[model samples]
Target: MSEPSRIAALVVAAGRGARAGAGDPKQYRLVGGESVLGRVLALLGAHEAIDRILVVTHPDDGDFYARTTTALAPAAREKLLAPVQGAATRQGSVAAGLARLADGAAPEIVLVHDAARPFLTPDLVSRAIAAAQAHGAAIPGISVVDTIKRVDETGRVVETPPRATLRAVQTPQAFRFAPLAEAHRTAVAAGRDDFTDDGALMEWAGHPVVVFAGEAGNVKLTHPQDFAATGGPETRMITRLATGFDVHAFTVGDHVWLGGVRIPHTRGVLAHSDGDVVLHALTDALLGALAEGDIGTHFPPSDPQWKSASSDRFLAFAAERVRARGGIIDLLDATILAEAPKVGPHREAMREAIARAADIPVSRVSIKATTTEKLGFTGRGEGIAAQAAATIRLPEEDA
Candidate 1:
């Protein structure tokens, strides 16, 4: 048997999508509390068949793209190749992505997808990949159920095509890499840039294309009404609660960081990061809810890069993982155990700082402080301890 065929996915997200209206482009817009592109990337990155993933983005959207990656798991983000700048047209953008893929050892198969569609499922991905391997090219399409119509510019009825013969196409359009690349190059050389989708370009190039069943739920966000219809940022969610605890011994510095807020203290906590015990415990709590891993798993103290790193990044990353899984941080409650530098004066500030780091409202965050009745290390003023509990809401299906 020969070596397994390498597969990759190209996500086209460079379009401005002005028709979708206002704010950021449609792909960057939030749907169910996660950016559309984030959801798309999550599904594709989780797919077993895909070996590598590439995203084509607009030149001006670099910052947006960077912000979007925060929503991905550390492992999923590793699969992504550096984003390539897209051109004025969709075809041009795809060509740019293809060029990036070609720069490395090209994969045997490639899936061209639209970042606007976030409901792609594992079954759909498997079918597309299998079909592409069997046939030179394949696309996912849904059979049309409504009456078909053909009209001229004058609004005169020209012809009514049979609905049974019509199918609405969807993306994760799969093709053998070589032929697709050749087709794109041929189209560019011929100055035929009118084709809207890669499958159409392949057809124009005389390549046989097959159609697989498409998923109805794999709808693309196209209009403002579409966002509203999908329930916008707030969707029905399943709630989960997780708890974390951490302890750090008092060391040399004169200040202590708690919940991302600095409190002037007689001694600091011994830690690799800024020693924000509250934020560290809260981050672990959020990560525990997702079952992704602990704080040490993501940011090992052994790594010099994370030494003295701000604990807020860990909290932000955990929160983004929740969003990537189509979840939200419902509430976070943390208690700091210490005997110095009273927390009462800085309670509201700590709450606000944690809220900012988790990208949640201050009202959803609660920070409290208490003594151990002179019983443990914390009560002896030798160390500080933090305990956190987080309630997260995720899609029930993901539960």
Candidate 2:
């Protein structure tokens, strides 16, 4: 009745992240200056449509989270609901998160996510939510890129699973709250502690889940090297800094594009056509000090045809606009913040991408990351947050 109260989100960060081999839990490690949990929360908090947010973390880590994650929006904080006790396993953590939901206010749908996945994108979350609403459950995942192997006790390959049928699942896993709550409760009642993620438990209970394509960049930071591998610091620049930040929320759409690459994500940027916030922010910063309008006025996210155009093209168009305006693009600095795909190792790649796309030297671009310190909307890792700034030189005035 009453449309089941729409949807809600539950983020599970309770894992100690021991496998990352860090002095502290990997979640506490600093990436681009902010902690992992902080980054995750930022993405979740940014989503405007989500009805509520529940963060389930370890009891020991609660105080730290409480102190560090103060950047969250007042409205989001009001809807905030967790940090409850998680079980020894991930499934346990979900149960704990569910238990923390308000007694009678359970959402019609729930999204379960992993805190280790700093690269989680808002588009991915939105897509999963859409799917969950259509079907009973939905998940974001990508087909395996590497060879698959089923190993034996001796650590030898016992069988090779076909790559075509296999998929590496990511979060946030979405499901109808009542069914998910029932599944978790049933699992716990049966002492079925082996479930690794919410999807598995749902499948076991006869729910057919729909899978959507996931971004190649969306990665889980399980090992210490993943941070570096995904676009963390080692590749970061130390001087002549320019920062750009831009955020565009969901409007009606079949999919959204980010980072110049097409992802099967949900909803296009709300601004002008090809709402490429990343490129727009970069362009504005490139010309920001010069007082130029952002990508919106130049490209106008409102135009109908730019409707499904590629954002990379917009960046290129911006580059041409800058050159025609007699400005020589210098160092381009940008950062993409979301709770989805890893961006650190990819920073260099992104630099290369921007450089090649703009026909500028690769050395001139710098891409770095930062979480919200787990304090604001970014802290919840809701919408994708990006900041960029460009250094440029304009022609001398004709006397």
RMSD of each: 10.3, 16.4
Please give me the total number of clashing residue pairs in predicted model 1.
0
Question: Tens digit of lDDT per residue, candidate 1, span 31-100?
Answer: 7767899878877876777878999999899888998886565445767999999998999999999989
- Estimated TM-score for each candidate: 0.66, 0.59
Candidate 1 worst ten-residue window by lDDT: 70-79
Give the per-residue lDDT digits (tens) of candidate 2, residues 269-370: 565556566666776675454455665676665677777576677677766665554445667777776654456545665666676566565667777777
Clash pairs, model 1 backbone:
none
Instruction: Output the number of the lDDT-best candidate.
Output: 1
Model 2 lDDT at residue 382 = 49
